[model samples]
Target: MARDLEFGDFTPAEKRRITALTARMVLPRANLTRLRRQVEDIEQQAERRKKK
Candidate 1:
């Protein structure tokens, strides 16, 4: 089963700082469409329980 995400674990200021840093560090260089495709592939493989 997929683990639940815990956004509540971070304080507001920490969350804001993380958000800003992630935007600056990750968003500019991220390939979102390719990431989406990789996620879909993983989901499909998990559904089928295909071993790597």
Candidate 2:
């Protein structure tokens, strides 16, 4: 089954790759904003779980 991704799931190199890809995109600004928000949400969720 497919699973949701958490921020901690990505390695530092992977995170850099994601950022690079996101930055090189020619998509609409709203779409890029949404992607950033999604990443923030994933990180937040991971942080909450880690605190438990």
Candidate 3:
């Protein structure tokens, strides 16, 4: 089953795990800059949502 994510609810370690997993999925199709930007964007958006 799938669980909804609350980025603010995660610890730093959990956040890093999420980021690493996402990078793994993205690596095959993306260059380093693209991968970095995608991860940064994900983190930034999640942070914005969490503040709401």
The list of candidate 3 runs beyond 4 A from truth reads 1-30
> Which run of 10 residues does model 2 get worst, by summed lDDT?
1-10
Residue lDDT tens for model 3, 4-51? 456665568657866785667656665776656666666665665666
**Each prediction's whole-model lDDT (CA):** 0.50, 0.58, 0.61
Clashes of 3: 0
Query: Which regions of candidate 2 fall more than 4 Å away from where they truly are?
Result: 1-30
Residue-wise lDDT of candidate 1 within 1-52, one digit each (tens)? 1133245544466456546554654577887666555544444445444333
CA shift of 26, model 2, Å: 6.7
State residue 44's C-alpha deviation in candidate 2, in Å. Answer: 0.3
Query: Clash number for every model?
Result: 0, 0, 0
Better of 1 and 3 by lDDT: 3
Candidate 1 colliding pairs:
none
Listed in order, each prediction's TM-score against the native is: 0.41, 0.45, 0.45
> How well is each residue in 1-52 modelled by candidate 2, as lDDT tens digits?
0155554666576567557656755655547666666666655555555556
Candidate 1, which ten residues in sequence have the lowest lDDT sum?
Answer: 1-10
